[model samples]
Target: MDRSNAFVLVGAVGAGKSSLFNVLFDKEEAALKTQAVVFETGGMDTPGEFFSHPRLYNALIQTVSDVGTIVYVHDGTDRTCRLPPGMLRVYGGKRVVGAITKIDMPECDPDFAERLLRENGVNDAIFRVSSRVRETVGPLKRFLFGELSDGPHACGDVERKKA
Candidate 1:
């Protein structure tokens, strides 16, 4: 389990999964391919189709073999979460982080995304960051690297699950 890139991310298409991944790690730029799985020294990025199709979920479940954390992304501009309830818990025992991408969009409401994620059993912290802006992603980076002190974030910092 390499901590450097031990995070694996999942989200529907257009949720900015690749943008966030690129910003988080200074990796070589590449054109985004449809339904392609991107693996790095530290993390893995899956295609949106994986989640939409139940059959592909096995691949995501199997991916847990290498990652220490799982992050589910939400597009703040989207009208709905799209994920089935309790989807975050599917990767049990792995730390899960929820992120709302495109938060800076004019009509984007990160709060709504956070609520949707929470209702879906994302007991840990839910973050709001605009992948388009590098600065907005720093908080998420800190949380991902376990750099923040543990506490309930009124503004969404890292938190422990309630039993």
Candidate 2:
């Protein structure tokens, strides 16, 4: 596996990173607790612990070291951001995008999630999607698969659909 050409998912616990991973990879099984890093076809799924715990920062850094891109998953219904300050700076050379998940949930606030993601350091394309909704995930999948063209929108300004 030439991980340098792949992408990796990172976020706090319950941010739906695993669910997005399963959806992106076309896995039919339920998402399980990601106790450790799991490598799949196009990307890698990282354990949230590696991101939320300061002590595990090294692990997270190492886990994504080889990947060319980083997808930071944020729960749309949550108001908090667990991404440590200057954490993403470590990967200055990697393409860091954002994904606001759970937009299908009634309580989700994608606008706030997008604001939080921007405040944290996701200056690239930010995708808002629901794992259960294939249509919503299309743009992201297309972008990741090198099929999405940079249409009228700039990188960080992609609007998410409201449920």
* Candidate No. with top TM-score: 2
Minimum summed lDDT over a 10-residue window in model 1 is located at 154-163
Q: Give the TM-score comparing model 2 with the true structure, all chains together.
A: 0.89
lDDT of 1 by residue, 117-158 (tens): 877766677777765566677777777766777864323322
Tens-digit per-residue lDDT, 27-104, candidate 2:
878899999899887788989898778999999988888888899999988999888788788967888889898887
**What CA root-mean-square deviation does each model show from the true structure?**
6.7, 3.3
Instruction: Say what the RMSD of model 2 is.
Output: 3.3
Alpha-carbon error at 70 in model 2, in Å? 0.5
In candidate 2, stretches whose alpha carbon ends up further than 4 angstroms from where it belongs are 152-163
Candidate 2, residue 75: the lDDT equals 91
